[model samples]
Target: MARLRTLFTALTLSSLTHAYIAPISTPSTHIANNDDDDNSDTPLPLIIWHGLGDNYAADGLASVASLAETVNPGTLTYIIRLDDTASGDRSATFFGNITLQIEQVCEELAAHPILSTAPAVDALGFSQGGQLLRGYIERCNFPPVRSLVTFGSQHNGISEFQSCSATDWLCKGAQGILRSNTWSSFVQSRLVPAQYFRDPTQMEAYLEHSNFLADINNERVLKNQTYKKNLEKLERFVMYTFEDDTTVIPKETGWFSEVNGTEVTLLRDRAIYKEDWLGLRTLDEKGALKFEVTGGGHMTLDGELLAKVFSENYGVYGRPFDGQKETDYPREKEL
Candidate 1:
């Protein structure tokens, strides 16, 4: 368990180290919206949300944007940024409130000329960014989302807070607050990670104190029908989990499974799905909800896997993202 938690922390903290060291040799110079007359030939605009400890300026993110451009030409790739500068954006990922961050993103996305004018946009979320986009979709989907794809996201919330380095005061400070008083309103509102800390042993506390996940999941007493209604509007929803993901404790969370000791409750069997609180049941029935897996530790993605994802779920003209996309993969089942 200790080793697993350490690995999870690495995914958050050390992943940044990798990004910082390996620089973008030739950064993408193209503007987000380069199309002269957007038409059926052009693919739907793709917006990406970077994970924890990461910003839009990272080389990996640039590579992803470049790859999407290559795989599907005339693709407009937008990487969401909370702050103007890369350093500030990275800092915001650790300490600032996520609810406010999502709100800022909502406004920016809505005000953009290209995104606002377009019919709909597809989303690609990494780690924490995945859930943030979900929150955005559920709370305020101004333009609506055509397709949603997430990699290594904590959709069901995380059991453990990330460990931080000694020198990094911001991450260490957030860790202290999370570990010290996770259920406190102060921590829940201030610390970004605290909002999604769902403990199996503390069900009542989590439902009572969890501001983001519980509200979005409709786990609270008074359910918001709009969240469910808005989510059901998606053309396709895909979630990918790492095959050997030690970084995310209880990896089944990506599939919306509840983990308790040796027992695992798959999403289909859970009341969350059966009840269709978030409208996942609607998606599943229509053959839109896809569950996929990739080989790696945590966010270890290769070109081939990325190409496959982009090709199937995104690009090239009309229709709601080529529903089902691939026939080789079977329907989602217990892991």
Candidate 2:
């Protein structure tokens, strides 16, 4: 009896693994036929941008694609795979240039006839991919994307410390560094997030002149002029930040909050706070944005949770592509 039970368990596990590993349907070949006359345009195809050090074959991309499939079955889904190699060395993925990644993404989108001609499409970006997409939207003159949903993306830039915590040694050390202008300047320019960290006093001039974050966020040249306008064009903007994400350092950077019309690092002390800058704050003000904070690590939403977020926030499940108002979908209460 024990042997039989073990065999059954093994079979179940094998079946689950096979299900997860199943090849995703080709988006170009399996286009859905919308028969409903109420809807004018077909549902926009979904393009998924994988996280750093990941590819199309990554399990996380598969899971996200699966979740997208569940939301809009038979709809075409494209996975944007990035080449993480620098020169001939594959191990140089961490040093991969952001501008090149954006160019690659633009090239992929332009190569797709369906995506190029369509008015808008939906995008789901994970981790660094999300930040990359934000840059793409800001800089690229290609087709506009209506909805962009990010999972565990560092919008402001990643930090190595959370708020000043008395109990946490790491947080205390980080606080010490941040409080000192000399030490902060030395370390800040070294980190990726520091490039996009808009200081309250220093303003746009504070950003690293050469970093991708500064360029896309319009800090380097135009500075705040075109940044807000470009972000407000999206119909739906959703961001998910994990509660226990140590990878993004101070997780609030992922949340995108600001005080007195300027971005703020700490959310602890604030009166009027805006949750996002990547058009999400404006979308939220206009009832087009949804920001969710779940209990997990970085980019850890499973297929089920992902589906729930998409359905509840964006209403992609039964939503028609055109003719319906954005207000028709069930809107979540403000954060």
Candidate topping TM-score: 1
Error of 1 at 236 (Å): 0.9
Model 1, span 32-113: residue lDDT tens: 3223244347887999998778888888889888778876677899999999999888867765677789899999999999
Candidate 2 local lDDT, 1-335, one digit each (tens):
34422332332222122112233333433333334443443456787766544556655567667666656555577877555432222111233456665687788788788889876777777775677777777766366767788877776554332343456554454345443431244333333333444434454445544356656654344455455666688776777777776666445555554423334433223321243434444565576566567776665555456655555433233353333223322221221
Per-model RMSD to reference: 6.1, 11.7
Q: RMSD in angstroms, candidate 2?
A: 11.7
Least well predicted 10-residue stretch by lDDT in candidate 2: 11-20
Error of 1 at 233 (Å): 0.7
Superposed model 1: Cα runs more than 4 Å off? 1-40, 163-177, 320-335
